[model samples]
Target: MSPPRQPLPHRGRGAVSSPHARFEPLAREGFDDGWDIAEEAPPLATDVAMEAARSIISRNDSPDIGFDRSINPYRGCEHGCVYCFARPTHAYLGLSPGLDFETKLFAKPNAAELLTRELSAPGYVPQAIALGANTDPYQPIERRLRITREVLEVLSKSGHPVGIVTKGAMVTRDLDLLGPMGRAGTAKVAVSVTTLDPVLARRMEPRASAPRKRLEAIRALSEAGVPVLVLAAPLIPGINDHELEAILEAAHAAGAREAGYVVLRLPHELKEIVRDWLVEYYPGKAERVFAILREMRGGRDYDAAFGTRLTGTGPYATLTARRFETALRRLGMARRGGLRLRTDLFVPPVRGAPGQLSLF
Candidate 1:
């Protein structure tokens, strides 16, 4: 006989056709691992909700961050990095922090329209707007959604300075728009490389572009004269932390002139999900990893203090920072070199009169 089904958590979407809904849930006690043993469900019809956002620029005052205003074209990320800090955000939408965060995504279809209007506002001040801050702009759904590309087009046409960070090679497809903007000093790109070890990367990030592919994307962007920054983000301790020096070396060889890294941050539901993933994939080393994380996080799973959130607090975290800094210095990699897009260079596109400028 099959195991009894566990009650499905309310996702607030009114029960739909979910493949996992029919499967008899495995007993909670049977598995030796911590991951929820629910099977993959059938894909849902992706619905694009046109959010008529009052504004597009997100302002932040965090001292550690590089930019002030950022824009995210989509809500949930399909790449499904088990350690994403943004995963907890889906809870505010009344969605499950588990599968729903990865599967049920929301795209801002009106992002470009809203952004254009905002940029043309009476007192709009030009600043380098960041793309893919919360969730990747080039997630797999972007191929069909095209919301990110639309936003890029708006920025390009308006001569607005834009900085992008993504792990998707799909970004290369937008070089036609980005290259010109780059030459005009209005654009720069950052390609994040998590790990060169394919096996670890596959299990950690799942659907994100492979590490090698990300390097190729950096090379491609650099060749096109679009400055590329290599981002070695979310460096999980005792997991893929050993690759620090190697990641920098590889990125430098790929023509990356700048590099940056963030210590792994597990906020709220992300702690549970990432821990579950660790137990499932590296059962034996799971304990060691968690122990190291606790050491870095002041004996907790994570620390969210403003100055210490992105980079952890304790000795281990400090050591990791030192190691990364040493490598960057040796490689002559400056943190802010690749993306120096000039906001002073912005010139708004002229909106011509409907029928008057046709032959003029």
Candidate 2:
């Protein structure tokens, strides 16, 4: 067995190190000698495993977000956004939610097939299914795998309403499908722009599309008739919070008709992951950042309260929300409701497909 040592930073990867999952019984770390002979951590190469998912659509009763159902094409995201709220989910697979969450991934190549089976079931009622609600559907690997593309094709063919949220420029690759669906009011897309500064964006979301590319994607999608919404998400206090208006302005210029925002959420193992990242990159501001985050989160790293989880509580979070609303009004955009998709147009995909359907 190799000596357990701290992993070094890998360029283009968001996580600084990989920590053991929460459920592990025995935890271990490094023992360094005075001579400093520890090997350097190599650049992480992404590896993907195929999962034959039994079902595709995921239902949630959470009151915060608009959607009731969502679909995740891949288990772990390769975008490597250190601040991703979905990071802790990797622990359920008995893997570290740090580096392993980005380096080691699983693709549901059978996702579209499974979705067809679910949509065709008797008493199946259609609602807007969210794509990329957890992990990005158009992550780099999808450029080759095309699993997301297949799922979109299935959704388009059946006229099923769907909405997509992504930070990838690769979403434009499916404009051929999304264009018609958007015009038909059966589909819409939300492009998440974290920051306008390329440098800050690189450090935060390493492998996701650059800030400029995302803006361009918004322009293209909008031109194709998709009701594009700019999602200024996970606004990190004392870090990128100051850029709220700028991000919205750029997206509005790029043709985004609506917008939304979510304050940073540090759930489960992510507290350590983000804390270490701040210490490394913004050491001077690290202390101040957490203080502001806690102030918004009721003196805690996170709160799961249904209504306030996405926004938060107290003055700082309230100020952020106020600024968001004010910007929307300034942009001549919708102040409250986001772009809604049409579920009334859905048609069953398959007559009788193999496998048991989702009970939801």
Candidate 3:
């Protein structure tokens, strides 16, 4: 017998239901007229579990991605953006990629220590390390955990280069460290402003910072002498696609020097999660949205092919690219190119006998 399915939770969240993983038996619940009604279900509380990661740095070889090494201080993001490509990763932990992925979070408390040790290794080479590649490092819980701040301290002390991408305004709290790094050409920040529409932002990313706050963050970072880049990511077709030029104009006016964009990518379980969200929130335009998405993905929900995954290969995709380029050029925004960080300033940590005297 299949496991019984439960009704979607009523909390202000993104996912509609937690469908069984592929490895688990499929099931669905049915309602009967004989059931009695009671009070509404209470909201689910966020659960954070600690994970002592053996390693801190993750290496990637994809040509499309810019950074070679990256770190994710948290496992599952609480931002709860329905279009997050990282949602499917939670299934490997035997958890649902829907609601469970957002509510059940994991924190790597020892990330700073692990990073220090790794950078101290003899074979370690200094390179730009990307933060928040998989999950936002400065999520709400980070205010108390301080794991991300600790990691930054280690990198700053070592003179290592680092790049951060986030939607959290909390990043401004670390201006003391980032300001110096930026002046030394060792740091850069990309603030993702998905949409200027507050209502749409709330419905899509239930727990993320408001759009205006993100814009303020960009301006603050820019004024602090940090190189700020605007990322209008996951541009949903027929939904927020119309806001492309408007987002760029807003970011540019807010002091962003460069801008980039990515079309909506629904990989693995994200397709179902996002579809459900659209049905519940945007019932009228759900079908039209899917139609445009399919047209961009070559008549499929998604195409994982390496070269064309980030930017699809179709008329709709081409049109989006053109529109973005045209807007960027007209706004005098610099095109994103190679961002080189200073590796010459790196100073590997020194660890020897406690009282050993140094010899020149």
Candidate 4:
């Protein structure tokens, strides 16, 4: 049976409210739509927070990724990328992975304070901390939230090195902070540009900054002396695959010093969301897209094995990698070898009242 489609709610233009739609778990009669173009109606969210004692880090053991520690100031991204792997995480909070992941958002208002405490801890280690590994640090709510900026202030004050991945041009607002970090070797930024086609980008990453704006962001970050990395992440075959070379060339010309790519990964609820998106927007190409993805993923929708998941297996995957590598080589850009971050610089905060002297 086809999944029922409901009208997704919009918080009006430029409101920046969480726009994810909820999936009604049980069968109901009124919600049938052939394409499953569900409109996720959700109330505008007010900030809810948790007091974090030490929020500076999270350790990861996934061999597929390079970084060991990461910091996310928010939960539930507003960008609403249908292919996002982080969507499943919302389920743990008793939220529907479908719309709740995007509509009902959470903010870590104390992230900056906790980060400062963590940085000052006695045994704290400082490898390059990753920002936006899960939820985008610079999502639209950030304009008012300012949590991400607060955390950056903590990192900058401590002289800690950090790496960031984001799709928002809002990062430009922090040029004052990032430029100094870049000069001091304390910061680097990578902007993910999935496709240059505005139409495709609009449908796929409904709320993300437009493609041209992202290239402009690359230019701005580069001009500010920040080492910029261009990421053509989660490349969807038969969807935006044809834009690969063009995107790389555009980003390189726009001053991206390094480049990388990840094939589309549809893990958990994302499979249904992305499938629904395709059927709605590209009805004729949906089957072919899924077919190519399956072929690349060893005949499954997705293979979660660390090594094979990020980059798929089989002939089609190999060709995609080859294409990316050739583009990188021609542009005089490296394949983004492991970036070793400084961990020895971490200093744990003194444990005592604000002004109390600690005798160690």
Tens digit of per-residue lDDT, candidate 1, span 211-269:
98999999888888888888788888778888989999999999898888888888776
* lDDT to native, each model: 0.78, 0.89, 0.86, 0.78
Q: Where is model 1 more than 4 Å wrong at Cα?
A: 1-50, 336-339, 350-360
Model 2, range 1-360, lDDT digits (tens) per residue? Answer: 454445456889998867789987867676655545546557789999999888899999887678899999998999999999999999999899999899899999888888888988889999899999999999999999999999999999999999999999999999999999999999999999999888998889999999999999999999999999988988998889899999999999999988888889999999999988998789898988889888878889898888998888998877888898899888898743556778888878764445545345
Query: Each model's TM-score?
Result: 0.85, 0.94, 0.92, 0.86
Q: Against the true structure, candidate 3 has what lDDT? A: 0.86
Rank the models by TM-score, top first. Answer: 2, 3, 4, 1
lDDT of 4 by residue, 1-360 (tens): 654554543442112222232343543245455756656655555334443434557889888787888999888878877778888787667665655666668888888777777777666667788999999998888998899999898788677889999999999999999998886677899999999988777766777899999999999999999888898887888888788899899999999978888888887767777776676567898899999989988889989988888889999888988999899889988676434445445445544566787687
lDDT score, candidate 4, position 281: 66
User: Model 1 lDDT vs. the true structure?
Assistant: 0.78
RMSD of 4: 4.2
Candidate 3 residues lying further than 4 Å off, grouped into runs, are 1-9, 25-41, 351-360
- Residue 69, model 4: Cα distance from true site in angstroms: 0.6
Please list the residue runs of candidate 4 whose C-alpha ends up more than 4 Å from where it truly belongs after superposition. Answer: 1-56, 338-360
Q: Could you tell me which 10 consecutive residues in candidate 3 have the lowest summed lDDT?
A: 1-10
Please report how far candidate 3 places residue 16 from its true position, in Å: 1.9
**Model 3 per-residue lDDT tens digits across residues 1-360:** 433343544566768766565555665555545443534446877899999899999999988888899999999888888898899999888888888888899999999889878998877888899999999998888999999999999899889999999989999999999999998999999898899999999888888999999999999998998888899898998789899999999999999988888888888888898888887788898898889888888899898878788778889889989998999889999865445789999987654554564352
Q: What is the lDDT of residue 198 in candidate 3?
A: 94
On the 0 to 100 scale, the lDDT of residue 152 in model 4 is 90
* Candidate 4 or 3, higher TM-score: 3
